[model samples]
Target: MADRMRKPAEETKADLDKLFLEKSRVKETMSDVLAKLTANRPKDALQFIADYFQSTFEQSKRLDKCYRCIMMTHHSRPVYQQNIASAFDILNQSKLGKGLYGVTGSIFDELITLILQGTPESHIKKMTDRLSRRRYEAVTYHVFHYAVTILAVYKDYLRVAEDLFELLDVNSSGQVDKVYADLLLTQLSTTFDHFKKDCHSGIQAGISLSPDALHTTVSKVSRNATGKEFIDCKHFLELSADVYLSLLQPPD
Candidate 1:
């Protein structure tokens, strides 16, 4: 992934100037469109805010894309401050937008940072109250930076995802085994289904299990069942795959 924080000071300065000019042009165009729309029927402030946000994102994507392409620039410092100010401006213009209770600067930071970190618009919508100017900025900034650190350390969210999957796989088999697998399937049917259908298909055929499953499986298989003893990692691996298969194709 391209580094968002690698831009030089000079490049950032140049980019900021260009971004500002483009934003001004877009604001003018949006004003004209809104004026025409409100000519006959009056729209509430929230509706207008929503419209402006949609249009702004559309028009601003060019600049946003450009910013994404380049490394973070010193020039961006001022622009970033300005953007925060603009976000507040939108919030102040709407009645319902401002009436949100418990809104804080941290929340605004959190919401905006999530947006910058590529969180889906739908997810952001689910957090509309927290995303307000007062709250998002306050809550998200530090957390978002931490999220960025995790991204940097792991290289990608999918890698973290892989780690989580492995943690549940137990037995080093490509899948969960019968007992543990059955429990997981019963407890998280939808998640289990989605995991197998989507997430498991591409994982390396190796298994790792959650803590309790590991202890139980080890205890059960070592119970002096004589010929049924599990001796090594290979045994564990086979057990895992067997568990996975049984869950996937249980007899009716």
Candidate 2:
């Protein structure tokens, strides 16, 4: 009897260890989702959260982390992610299924890839220029959110990526200057051709422009480039309401 009892205790200990290990994975996955949420890629962030829940469900066949998975998964939706309090509530709840997780995870994976490809360097420059005109308008707020959302949803939707970047591209020129260029050229080849091109472009452009022209262009772009131009976070909240309402409207 004593030996049998001891074996059961050992088994229980092993189970606890496994459970804790899975919990650790949940924590890491949660961290990853939070990071993505705060990044330029909210959709990708959502997908990451979804993927974690899905994977955990499949592997563990347990509900311990389901609440978080559900919360993050729901929050990834553009509408829900915008709401801090509601998102928090959902994140606080129960178990998710393995099958559901797998499907959602695949969807996110595809979206992320599409968004990334859409915003190539050349496209970004052109799109920024096109969209910069709305900088001072009320529409600018919607436009900014729209751009970010599009980037999130389309993930590498190169055509739309180009359009968004062109709208943001204040310079209206074909190339990115060295300073703004860094946003485009994140990776460096051993030859560094991309970096060199950007550097050369900025220097040449800087030299060619009169100081006044350069200052005007920079001023225009700088004023709205950082997210500070947004009157409040709620600007998007309001816009989303309108957009959703529009979606619900009857077909023309």
Candidate 3:
């Protein structure tokens, strides 16, 4: 009985050791990728990730690893983070749609998680500002919608929700108003549910929010707000940008 008990304990210890070793290896790989990106060799780093993803037999496992690698980039130096974001844009424009979807969607999801977990305000602002200047508005909007859904799904995020509203009400208006607020909330909620459903089974490309659609939504709301205060087009865009910035802050 003693021998049998000792064997089980030893197996448990070995399993934990194996887990730690795998984690360390992953960290090392991500570090290497970051080094290449920072050195202006983004193509090489992307190629390495592509090879790793291709070599992995399990799709889910490969995606999870890819996600971790991309998330790790967010914690890198600001310049490198900008490089990685630019690399993503280049990939999206090239024949690397698979990498773009896997990496970009994961990056957005991770940013939302970090913000909800209480990252610092300044860091988030800097990261989002960088991304916006790089013309990643679609990704930024997607992240904002995700963050709002998280606040909706988990009632515990009520405090964050208040802060988000304040940020969205760009002109310091008391509220987002009923019509425009409802429209924004409904659109975000629907997209969030669809994205969540897809993510449950596997990673999917993020849904891009078209500027035309946003403009139309704003137009309708503005016209409807003839007699009352409402979030206008300019203020709406500013609020969206601010929300994006808020979500980008580094974790505390």
Candidate 4:
């Protein structure tokens, strides 16, 4: 009896690793819905869950058309890559971007340190390193597509992604300027601040922006040609998707 070992279950390292991967993926997939459900407290959560996934399924079909549209518009691999690189270039320049102010000394005001606010720095660096074969950095079409595929398999971020893109591309333009994106982010930050003031756990729940930050950001971005550069809608969508994905990671 002493020599013989009996356990209810036995899981080798491989089994445990596989289980962990699946568990992490499933949890990440359900995070948004779970957060929404908790916040809203629907009358029937079970039914709500079912409906959420169903709506997401329909959204996925439309999302597929988005990818198809991108591929079709480019028409060739080289063209697609060139455009993707251009967009990435815009983002790479903007991520650590320093806003300028009236020359007090040799230094610019540095109002906007990073446009991708609140995400892990490692993710931003990794993305930049990944796409940057040269001076510019961005998510390649293959990487973007694969990442989107992962999201689709998990929770279908397509709808959310689409909604964000349309909202950002105000004026219904096929592309949006970096300056405009800065303004939008500033507005979002302000709104979040307002909510934080009203709520108890505001710091944890909201992102805040100072009043002057907006004015300075606008001034700097508007003056720079790169800030005025128009990034393709699909490329912007990919950048935003990466931001959303990075937010899912637990802080180190």
What are the runs in model 2 whose C-alpha is more than 4 Å off? 1-119, 134-140, 156-252
| Candidate 2 Cα deviation (angstroms), residue 147 | 2.2
Tell me the tens digit of each residue's lDDT in model 4 across 188-238: 444444443463544433232333444465556665546446776556545
Candidate 2 global lDDT: 0.37
Question: Which pairs of residues collide in candidate 3?
Answer: 123-249, 124-248, 124-249
lDDT of 4: 0.44
Candidate 2 TM-score to native:
0.18
For each candidate in turn, the TM-score is 0.24, 0.18, 0.26, 0.26
Query: What are the per-residue Cα lDDT tens digits for candidate 2 across 1-252?
Result: 765667877989989998897745556566655764576454566586677567545433322232233234332465544543332233223123323222122222222233334344443433343323321122222332343344333232232224423433556654333333222222111112322345345444334333454455556556445542322212322332223222321212
Models sorted by lDDT, best on top: 3, 4, 1, 2
lDDT of 2 at 180: 33
Candidate 2 local Cα displacement, residue 168, angstroms: 33
Worst 10 residues of 3 by lDDT: 201-210
Better of 3 and 4 by lDDT: 3
- Higher-ranked by TM-score: 2 or 4: 4
Q: Report the lDDT tens digits of candidate 3 across residue range 1-252.
A: 765668877989989998897744566556644664577555576686666555332433443443344445433245534444543443233222345433344344334344434534443444444432222223443343334334333322233334445544667856665466556645544444454456442122122223456456667677675436555433443444344344333322
Ranking of all predicted structures according to TM-score, beginning with the best and ending with the worst: 4, 3, 1, 2
Candidate 2 lDDT score at position 53: 63
The predicted structure with the larger TM-score, 1 or 2, is: 1
**For model 2, what is the error of residue 73's alpha carbon versus the real structure, in angstroms, after optimal superposition?**
8.2
Q: Is candidate 2 or candidate 3 better by TM-score?
A: 3
